[model samples]
Target: MNRGKLNGVAGTTGALCAVVLLGNVMAPDAHAQNSVTLYGVVDAGVTYTSNAGGSNQYALTSGNMGANRWGLRGSEDLGGGLSTIFTLESGFTIANGKFGQNGTFFGRQAFVGLSGSWGAVTLGRQYASSSQFVGPLASGSSWAAPGMGYGTHPADLDNLNSTNRINNSIKFASANYNGLTFGGLYSLGGVAGDFSRNQIYSLAIGYTQGPVKLALGYLNVRNPNYSFWGNKANDSTTASNITSPVIAGYASANTQQVIAAGTSYAIGSATLGAVYSNVRFSGLGATPVAGLSSTAAAYRGSATFNNGELNAKYQVSPALLVGAAFDYMKGNGAGQGGVIYRQFNLGADYFLSKATDFYAVAVFQNASGVDSRGVRAVAAITGATPSTSSSQTVVTAGIRHLF
Candidate 1:
C-alpha cells in the first residue's frame, strides 16, 4: 500500500477509538435515558418475645427485614450539567398489603430534586435531620428484625429512632468539598397563609474519606414531638395554640431541639461506631419550677434531656455478618422517673446469594424507671398487635429477598 493511504487509515482508526470511548462514558445509559424502574422487597415471618406480662404475644408478622415496598425512581438529563431526579417509595404490609404507616402511600419517602455542581434541592416528604444523622450509625446496617431503634434513647431523648420519617418538607444538599458536605431541610406545617407558626428546621454536616465517616446535625421543630413523633402536628388548627409543657432534664412536652454527632471507622472485618446527641425538649424553652400558677400548667407541659450510644458490627465471612450494639440515656429531674433505657442486641445474617438471605436476630432490653420505659429497642422497631404491650426479649428469624 502507498504511504499516504496507510497514514489516512491509521488516523481514521485512532479517531474511531476515541469516539467510542467517549460515547461509553457520556452515554452509558443511552438506552434507558428516560426510563423508570420498579423495584421492591417482600419479607414476612413469625416473631416471639418473652415477658408478655399476661399478654398473648407470639404471632406471625410481616415487613421484617425489608418493608414490603414498591418504588419508582428516574432521572432526566438536561443540557448544560443539569438533571431532574425523583423517587417515590411506599411501604405495605406483606402479610395483608394493608400499607404501612396506617395505609399512607409513599409513607417511606417521596421527593424530587434537581442536581448539578452547586448541589441538589429536594422537595416533598422525607426523613428528619436527627434520623438522617444517627440512623447510619445505629439502624443503617441492621437486618435482624424489629426491636432495633424504635424509641430506646434515655426515654427516647435524641429520637435516634422511633423509626421516624419526615413529611411535608423540602431539603437542600450540598456538593462534596474536601470530604465535607452539608444539608438543610424545612418542613412547612402547610397551613394556608400562616407560615412559621408550626414549622421545622434542620441542618446536617458530614465528612468522609476512605474508611472513616463522621456526621453532626441539628433540628428544631415547634410542637415537634406531637408533630413528627405522634404524627399530630399536621392536624393543628390556627385557633388552637400549642399547649405542650416544657421540663428541663427529661422527657415531657412537644417542643424539641436535638444536636447529634457520630463517627464510624472500618478496620478489615470490623466496623466501630459511637454517637453522642444532646436532646433538649422544653415548652418554649421555659423552665419555671418555683411557684407556678395553675394557669401556666394549663398552657404548657415541659421537659428536657440528653442521650448517647455506642454500636459496632463485623463481617465474619463473605456470606455471614455479626453485629452487637448498646445505648444508655439519662435524665436530670422527675422526667427521669427512673426513665433510663439500655439495649443489647446480637444478630447474624447468612446470605443465600446477592438477592436472598436469612437472618437470626436477638435483642434484650431493660427499662428501669417507668413501667413502659425499656420495652422498645433503640435501633429496632418492635411491631406487634396492640394487645401485646409487654416488652422484652425479642427473637426473630426471617428470610429476605430483593429484586
Candidate 2:
C-alpha cells in the first residue's frame, strides 16, 4: 500500500509540472524581443600648461579629448516598427577613479523613451539640441579627437563642445529624410510657483549630402546661472555658480541666448570646417551676486560675445590624421570694456586598432582688453586653470580605448 501511495504522488507531481511548463510556453509576452548592451571608453594623458595661475605645471589628466565613461543601452521591440529604448551613462575621472559631473552616478545621461520610423522622443537629463546637432562640425568634437576639450573656443563660451547638459529635459529627434534631420529640446525648471524659472529650450537642424554638411542651432535659457551652470537643486537667485572667469560677471543675468552655425566640406583626403556663434546675457542686475566677481556690479544691461572658428584636417594615411584650427572671440557691453581672445590648435592621431588610438594636441591662446571682472583680461582655457597673464599654452599626449 505504501508503494502504491508513492507512485500516485509521483504521478500527480509530474502532471502539475507539465501544466506549468505548458502555461509558460503559451504566454504571448514570453517571446518578446529585447537586448541590452554595455559600452565604455577609457582615456588618459599627461599634460603641460604654460602660465597656469602664474606657474607652469605638468600633470596627469583624464579626458584630454573625450570624456571617460561607461554606459548601458537597452532596447525592446514592441513590434510594428516601434521600439522602447533607454540609456544610462556614467562619467568618471580615471586618474583617481572618482565620479565626474559633481559625483552624480549617471551624470552623463539617463533617459528612456520610444522610437519609430518617424523619430524618437526621450525624457531625462540630456545634451541640448545645439550640442547634439552642430557640435560635430566644430573641430573640438571632430578630427581634433583625443584633445577636443583643449581645442574648444575660449572657456567653451558657445557650448559647441558640450560643456553642459540639461536636466529634466524632453527631447525630440526626427528620422533622417534624404540626408536632412532636425531636433529640439525643452527643460523644465521644476521650481515651485514659477513655470519659467530656470527653464531652457533649444532647436537644431542639420543636413549632410555626400561631402558637404551643414548645421544651425539656437538655445535660450531663463536664469542662466541657475539653469545651465548650477546643479539642478540650486535655486538661490542671490548666489552664483559661474566659475569660469571668462563670463563670471554675467552670473546675475536673467536670461541667456545663443545662436550658432557650422559647415564642413570634404575634398579627397582633406576636410575643411567653419563655425560661428553669438552669445548674449541680458537683463543684468545692478548688483553682483554674493561671492561672485565684483565686476557684476558694473553691469545693468546686456553682454554679448561673438565667436568664429575655422579648421582643417587631412588624412595622412589609413591610420594617421592631422588637423589645425584657429578661433577668435570678442566680448562687448555690460561694462566689459571690450575683450578679445585669439586661439590656435594643432593635433594628430594614430590608430593602433579599430578600438584604440594615440593622440597629441597643442593649444595657444592670447587675451586682451578688459574682462568681465573689470580688470585686465587673462587667458582662460577650457578644463584648465586660468592664466595669471594674457597668454597661455597647453600640450597633451594621450591614449584612448573603446569597448
Candidate 3:
C-alpha cells in the first residue's frame, strides 16, 4: 500500500488523462479542433469594346470571371449545434495590385457571427437581405454572366451583386428549413437626432426545392445619395459616383426603394432563370450636371424603373458551360418618361481544374427613349465605357484561379 500502490494510482490517472485528451481531439464535434482557412481568387482578362468614351478600345482587366481577392474564414464550435464564425474578404485588382471596392481592404465582406440550428446573425459590413436572397437568381449574379460586372441587372441598380455592402449592419439569416430560408438586414445611419436619415434596410425570403429556386425581397434607403456616397461628417459626395448613364442623373434622390423577385429551374444539365425588379427613386433632388444650365432640373421629382431578365445556362460537359441572358428595362419619373433599355449577354467557360477556369463573355446594350433628365439615354455597362450613342458592345476573355 506504499510506493507500489502510489505509483500504480499515478499511472492510472495519467492514462485516463491521455484518453480524455485524445477523445477531445478525435471527438466528432470537438470545439478545440476549430480552424481558420485562407482562400482567394486571382483573375485577369483581355477586353475590347465596340465603343468606349465614343471610340473603340482595348485593355487588360481583373475580376472578369470573378473578383480577385483573398480572405480568411474561421469557425469555432462551442458544443451542441452552435458555433462562432467570422469572415474577412478582400477584393483586389490583380492587374495592378490595387484594392477593389473603393480601396477598402475587406470591401467584399467583413462579418462576425454565431451559427446554430436555427440560423445565423452577423454584424458589420454585409450584403443587404435583398441582394443576399434574390441576387443569385440572376444570370449575371450566377454562372451565365461573368467578367467583372458584365452580367449584373443593367447598372446593377438593384444591388444584385451587392456593390454597396451595408456598413454597420446587423443581419439575420435563417437556416434552411425544408429548402426555405429568409433573412433581414438593418444598417445604422449613425446620424444623431435622425434615425431615418441615411438609413438602409431590407428583407428577403427564398425557397429551393430540387430543380427549382425562388426568391423575393424588398430594400429601402433613406437619403439614397447620402447614404451610399456621402462622407460621414458632412454628407458630402465622395469621389466615386454612379457612372451608368441609365440612372446616374437620378442618383441624388432622398429615398430609393426596390422590390425584386426571381426564379430558376434546373432541367438536366441546363438551368433557366428569370428576374424582375421594380425600383423607385422618390423625394427627388436636383442634380448638378457638369455642363447643364444652372436652372435646369437635371434630376428632380420622382422616377421608377422596371427591369426584367431571362437567362439560361447549359453545362456542355463536366468542364465546359455555355450561357446567355436577355434583359429589358423601362423607366419613368422625374419628368423623364418612357426610357427603355435592351441588353444581351452571352458567355462560356471551360474548367481546367476545380480551382481554375477560362471564360469568355460578350454584352451588348441599346438605349431608347428619354433619360431621367429628359435626354436620350446612353448605353452603359457597369464597368465599361458609356457609349457615345445609344448602343454599345463589349467582349472579354479571361482566366480565374481560386485557392
Candidate 4:
C-alpha cells in the first residue's frame, strides 16, 4: 500500500508540472510589449554682455542653446490602438547642479495620459497652446542656438518661446489630419472662493504640408500676476514675481490676453519665417490691493503690445546651419507712454554628430520711449538682466549634447 501511495504522489506531481509549463507557454509576454526610454540634453557656454546693470560682464552660462534636462518616457499598450503613456521631465542648471523652474523637481513637465488614433489627453503642469503651435515657427524657439530668447520679443510677453507654463492643467491634442492639427489647454485656479482667479485657457491650430507651415494661437489669463507669472502656490494679491521692467507695472492687471500667428516656407536649402503677436493687459489698477507698491499702483487703464518678427535660415551643409532674425515691439498704455524695442539676432550651428553640436549666437537690442514704470525704456533681453542703457548686446558660444 505504501509503494502504491508513493507512485500516486509522483504521478500527481508530474501532472502539476506539465500544467505549469503549458500555462507559461500559452501566456503573452507583457514585458516585451511595454517600453521605457531615458532621454536628456546638456548645454553649457561662455557669455559676454555689452551691458548689464551699467557694466559689461563675462560669465559662464548654462542652457544657452537648450535647457539642461533629463526625463523618462514610457508607454504600455492596452490594445485596440490605445496606449497608456507617461512622462516626467526635470530641468536643472548645469553650472551649479541646482534645480530649474523655482526648485521644483519635474518642473518642466510631468504628465500621464492615454493616446490612440484620435489623439491624446493629458493632465499636469503643461505648456500653453501658443508655445506648442506657434513657437516652432519663431527662430527664437527654433534654430537660434546658444539662447532660445536671443530672437524672441522683449520679455517674451507673448510667450512664443514658452517662458511660462500652466499648472493644474488639462490638455488635448488632436491627431494629424492630412498635416493639420489642433489642441487646447485649460488650467484650474484651485482658489477656494473664486473660480476665475488665477485661471488660464488657450487654443491653437497648425498646418504643415510640403515645405509650408502655418500656425495660430490664442491665450487668456485671469489675474496674470498670480496665474501666469507667479508660482502655483503663490496667493499674494498685491505682490508678484515679475521683475522685468517691461511689464512689471502692469502686474495688477485683471486680465492678460495674447494672440499670435506664424508661418514658414522652405526653399531648397533656405527657409524663411514670419510671426506676429499682440499682447494686452486689461483693467490695470482696477483693484487696489492693500500694501501695493507705489510703482504698481500708479498704473491705470489697459496696456497693449504689438510685435512682429521675420527670420531666415540656410543649411550650408548636412551638418552646418546659419540663421538671422529681426524683431520689433511696440507698447502703449494709459500713463505709461509709448515704448518701442528693436532686436537683431544671428547664429551659426555645426553638428558634430546626431547627438552633439557646437553653436555661436549674438543678439542686439535697443529700446526707446517711456516704459511701463513711467521711466526711460532700457534694453531687456528675455533671459538676461535689463541693461541700464537703451542698447545692449550679448554673445555666446556653447556646446549642446542630447541623449
Lowest lDDT block of 10, candidate 4: 1-10
lDDT of 1 by residue, 23-85 (tens): 468978644445445566777667776655434367666766556776656677875888887
Q: What is the TM-score of each candidate against the true structure?
A: 0.76, 0.90, 0.87, 0.89
Evaluate model 1: give its TM-score.
0.76
- Write down the TM-score for model 4: 0.89
Task: Please tell me which model should have the higher TM-score, number 3 or number 4.
Answer: 4
Global lDDT for candidate 4?
A: 0.84
lDDT, each prediction: 0.60, 0.83, 0.79, 0.84
For model 2, what is the error of residue 280's alpha carbon versus the real structure, in angstroms, after optimal superposition? 0.4
Q: Return the TM-score for candidate 3, rounded to 2 decimals.
A: 0.87
Per-candidate RMSD vs. true structure? 11.7, 10.2, 10.2, 11.2
Estimate the lDDT of model 1: 0.60
Worst 10 residues of 3 by lDDT: 1-10
Pairs clashing within candidate 2: 65-146, 65-147
What clash count goes with each model?
21, 2, 3, 2
| lDDT at residue 6 of model 2 (Cα atoms) | 17
TM-score rank, highest first? 2, 4, 3, 1
What is the Cα-based TM-score of model 2?
0.90
The Cα error of candidate 4 at residue 295, in Å, is 3.9
Residue 346 CA displacement from its true place in model 4, Å: 0.4
Candidate 3 lDDT at 355 equals 85
